[model samples]
Target: MGSGIPVWSDLTISDGLKYISGSYKIAMVYSGDSAPMLVLENKHSYSWDICISASEVSSGVAFYSYDDIAQAFSNYGVS
Candidate 1:
């Protein structure tokens, strides 16, 4: 994984979501499973106004945390 972050490649999206929706901080999202859309955890309060967009071809793992999402947007000056 990039930046030396360990990615659980063995875990499927459903399995990853189970842990992510609970306490797990990160997961690897395969290119095939990712789409051009925002995925927010409804259980947590988030800034609905923030819009971060990326291409479908930018394949990589992503974090589900609000802080991570916000940082990603900030990186692109979208926040």
Candidate 2:
């Protein structure tokens, strides 16, 4: 797969929040000793990919849309 982020046009933030809040299937990809990367797949045709630092893995942060992720980054002055 390409390293570029995936685009999800059909999913909304509310939908993502509900999926995370409810039971969902997740796939974990680990690289060396670093924290495992997490992914939540949409049964249809997309997935939400998250890469958390080792320290923040235990502190759950739910993201429901691209806007949500963008807002979070903006909060940290990542724009």
RMSD of each: 10.4, 11.0
Q: Please, what are the lDDT tens digits per residue for candidate 1 over residues 1-79?
A: 4234244322124433344333344443545555334444323444444433443233565445545565755665654
Write the residue-wise lDDT of candidate 2 on 4-78 in tens digits.
233332223345544332233332233344444333343565443333332233234322334444454455554
The residue ranges of model 1 lying beyond 4 angstroms of the native Cα positions read 1-63
Task: Give TM per candidate.
Answer: 0.24, 0.25
Error of model 1, residue 43, in angstroms: 24
Model 1 scores a C-alpha lDDT of 0.43
Give the Å error, residue 74, model 2: 12
Best by TM-score: 2
| lDDT: worst 10-residue window of model 2 | 1-10
